[model samples]
Target: MRRPRYYTPTEVSLHNTIDDLWVSYLGRVYNLTPLVEEYKGNILLKPIIENAGKDISHWFDPETKDIRTHIDPISRCVKYYTPRGRFVHVPPPCPRSDWVNDFGKPWWRDGRFEVGLLTAKTRWIRIINTLTSQEQMLEVCSEDTLDEILQCYLYYNSHAASYTWKYDGVNLDMSKTLSENGIPDKDEEFYQCLMDRDLYTESICLYFNDDLSEI
Candidate 1:
């Protein structure tokens, strides 16, 4: 089985659109595109639309892993405390004849919307192909191991696994994460990489190791 894909906040932010909305909450990433499409003209969708491609952890209770709620002052009953505004599948503070709770499971509670886990932290790295003289910059999860990162590099080099990954001339441990492999994270100066990418970005060079596995 393939490993569960990990996504950084920056990557999640790219899908900020009605037809491709995504959000992260309680350390999990969710694809809210269908929910938005199904409720396209809904006024309740406003807050979600405005906050697309952003973290909504504040909207949920970490302990319950569900939406935050509070006792309504007027109704004197518990209600979703959507300070931003009531959103899709959330019941109204008071009973309404038009309101429907037929949707089996709320979008947030449904497993279908869950795409992946939110990375605890993100970092940038440069992958250089010594043989082809080609290079690619990647925004990867700090929790990713060399093997997992190799999967990301496969788009640039299909035979990435056949290449020996090295950092500062020492071989990399496929099972270990970047920092565990002795690669220091320059997160404090990570933004500087935007100005001089090559100067601050750490590089992992790949040396092709010819093998019969290649067709």
Candidate 2:
């Protein structure tokens, strides 16, 4: 079964620009660049633009999984609570004749803008090549499979896919997560022991398979 892609906060933060805005909320990440382009000249875009490449989880209600709401002080009626002012698709606090509700669905509820889910946790891992004795420290998401981790390792070793990965003397299942492969995350233990996070990393040895496809 295919799993959803996971993104670290650092990867999402890099897209903090007008043409590539991204934000995360409630463990989900969204690429709001289209929303930005659709409402380019609208002043309601201020908050979204200013907050590009950031997490706006506070803008939503965890249980309801929707935008936060509050009662209108003067009218004694409930309305969308936007301290930064209303943005695109959000109805005005008060009803207005010009307000239109024909946009099909609100951007927040639209899944089209969503890119992927945020990784729940991150940990340091060291990858060492048995062939050349090269080593690199990498921070990886707990939910990531070995194949995904290999993609990150490509920066260090271009022949990562040509290697057989192993934790100890046993071979690893590339389709499964690190935990599923019996490699437990020790980040919490490292933290409790006051160990230097930089010095504390799980070692994964890679043996060359002699595959020449990458060459």
TM-score of each: 0.83, 0.92
User: What TM-score quantifies how close candidate 2 is to the native fold?
Assistant: 0.92
Per-residue CA lDDT of model 1 for 113-186, tens digit only, reads 99999999988899999998999999899999999999888887778888899999999999999999999987
Off by over 4 Å in 2: none
* C-alpha lDDT of residue 161 in model 2: 85
Per-prediction CA RMSD (Å): 3.4, 1.7
lDDT for residue 156 in candidate 2, whole number 0-100? 82
Candidate 2 lDDT for residue 77: 92
